[model samples]
Target: MLKKFAKQTLVAVSLAVSIPVFAASYTIGTGSQSGTYYPLGGILAKIWSENIDDFDMRAEVTAASVENTIKVATGKQLVGIAQGNVVLQANEGVKPFPRKMDVSVLFALYPNAVQFMVPADSDIHSISDLKGKRISLGAPGSGTRVSSVNILSTLGINESDVKPQSLNYTATTNALANGQIDAGVIVGSLGVGAITELALTRNIRILSFSEDDMQKIIAANPSYQPLEAPAETYKNVPAFTTPAVWNVLVVNKNMPQEQAYEMTKVAFDNMKKIRQVVGVTKFTTLENMNKLSGIALHPGAQQYLDEQMKK
Candidate 1:
């Protein structure tokens, strides 16, 4: 009888321990199938699943920044990626935000450039010159598309003036290479593999906005920063520079504080590894993560930020 009672007690204790194990399951909302967001989110998901205690996590490829932000805001996804400009706009109830989204910053994940690529033989020299040409503004609902619209708006070009093609990076690249499209716009980290590959495989030119035009763009959107896209960022791309913005990682307002804290720590702790995965520099620092958050930092992420600040 004594032995049987001990066995029952052990079984009860085991069940109790297993209860908390299944309590948490998380999903990360990434971007389209081929874009940078999907792969980056996948890496983060793997890191979280591997290191996070008693948590199950996975990455899902969605429409991209705008869609990902909505998913996080509405709790459809616990975590997601958003462009810095998009996050700021959404937080302030701008454009697609409709209502002020209660999303919080997990980290300023990376610096994404406003890469405007044109055919090697195209006469379009600046944003204004593309007024009458067929340009792939990026796929519908993507951050790239939104950025393209903003750039066009800066040049007094709206949807009505130019032919805007809604296509993904792969499709846009192919189209531009085959003379099917005159230009393609992409928002990606500095070393964009697709853009680099396209430049190497065929004749391509990186578009640049005039100084006055760049200033106009900056005035319109403060989140955009002037970045120099060095010649080495691509092959035979010439020593060209352009102004662009950054991308941010965001979480739903209701994400667990502890989970957010862990995620924040994981990002900073393994940032070296992340840099290898994504060509992000400068945005991963502790100071920038705290000072330049695209949206409100989660309470748990705040805790980590506080710790980092202290050190």
Candidate 2:
């Protein structure tokens, strides 16, 4: 009986040694729970956890783009989702960014269409109309707010000219629905939850940028690319052309090349799975990788892209 018990213990030990253990669980800092970044981060984390060999990634709710830049640069997060313009600002030590950040781009996600929305029946019809009207420009110091200010100023509407309300996407939408605010800015991917919810019962119109308006916005900041939101993107919303900033995935530049390469490859390989849930993620492809500017791609990411060239 003693020999048989010893034999079973030895077999159990061998089996345990043979099984692969998850090396580490990393955190990907994403935006608020109601925004696009959060869900996209969640989807990527789930895909990585399942597809990667002995690795797991979890998503953490964050204040979004601006905070994500600092988190990844400070080593507080392994990965993060941030707006492309914010990334450029962080790289260049622009306002809201104290100094140049040390980071690397992993992939370009999607565009955050800077959607200026107001009640459909409201007389507001142009960016200039926002003057003296209450506007919610995301949370204070957020990427969305940065875009709002940049665009407004480029279009000749200064912050002092408008009542700027610093609120999150959810609160901004709620405020608009409740008539507490005159206009709101939602800088997010198509079908952002807050806007989707508000559009369900409230008649909201997404203000679009005219051709000249877009040209000026982009000239001031090349990070702002123009995109059109399709009518089907949200209920009662029409297809409108607007200036957008690309959303991107990033990692600390210090991450080892092999790890970064592996992570980048894994994400692109499994991007189809991501697209299944979020159709907009279809932009997360090798073809769209050039969307980023002023930020260097990690060596590992470049290596992976090179490898794809061979394929």
Candidate 3:
């Protein structure tokens, strides 16, 4: 009886040793609370936490794309949502970033439309009309500010040509309503909440880019593509042309391959459900998945894509 009991105890120890223990936690950096990235990040975190065994994940609210990229690159966060142009610039050590970041792309999320708004009665009819008027480019470190600056520079409109105010989406809306700003540059998916709210009370106009202006913008930054804000997106507004950049999911280069693979798999598998929360999911297709602007794809994401292609 003593021999049998010792044998059973040894078997239990061996069994325990064979069982795999996995305890991993990660954070996804997203944009402001009022923006789509924040809520989308929450949905992804929930999906990952629920589906991945022994995984703990959370989403952090950040200052938007540029900040998200830097955080992810520096390992302050495991993953982040960033604009494609900004990601490319970060990878190349551009103005906003001090040096090249070791980051990899997971996938493209959506196109961020550059929506320039003015009060309906404002005299600013086109991008050119903003000269000598007050314009609210987005907050200093935000992707919107970079895009706005690029657009303005391409049009030969120097900083000295207009009075520029650094404001966020909500602040820009309030300023427009209060007549504190003549125009504001907001970058987001169609029918952004802030713009919707501002349009409900104040008559708003979305500026369109002329063909020449579009060419100039494209020439300056190939990452930007022509996009249109569909008619009826806002009250009494018509479809108008603008420039857009894709928002991508990025991870630090050091993220484990297995973890990144599983993360990508979970995201693509739940694409339909994710779309219910993030309208941008409509853009997250296999085609978009293959498009990595300037940034390299994480090896794990590439492995998953290869496996997907086989099926």
- TM-scores for all candidates? 0.89, 0.91, 0.90
Model 3: per-residue Cα lDDT over 1-311, one tens digit each: 99999999999999999998875888888876766788889999999989999888899977787888898899888899878888898889888889988888998888999999998887888998989989999987788888888889899997789999989888888999999989999988887788888888989889999999999899888998999778889888778999999888988888899989999999999888899987768989877885656667889998998898898
Instruction: Residues 1-311, candidate 1: write the lDDT tens digits.
Output: 99999999999999998875463788888876567787788878877777777767888877688988988899888888878788787888889678999788877766778889987678987777888789999887789999989878877999889888999888888898899988899888776667877877887778876788788888888788777777767766765556677677888877889888998898778777766776554467876774444457889998999987888
Clashing pairs in 1: none
Tell how far residue 193 is off in model 2, in angstroms. 2.0
* Pairs of residues clashing in candidate 3: none
- CA shift of 301, model 3, Å: 0.9
Question: Against the unseen true structure, what C-alpha lDDT does each candidate score?
Answer: 0.80, 0.88, 0.87
Top lDDT: which candidate number? Answer: 2
Candidate 3 ranges beyond 4 A from true positions: 1-23
Please list all clashing residue pairs in model 2, or write none if there are none.
Answer: none
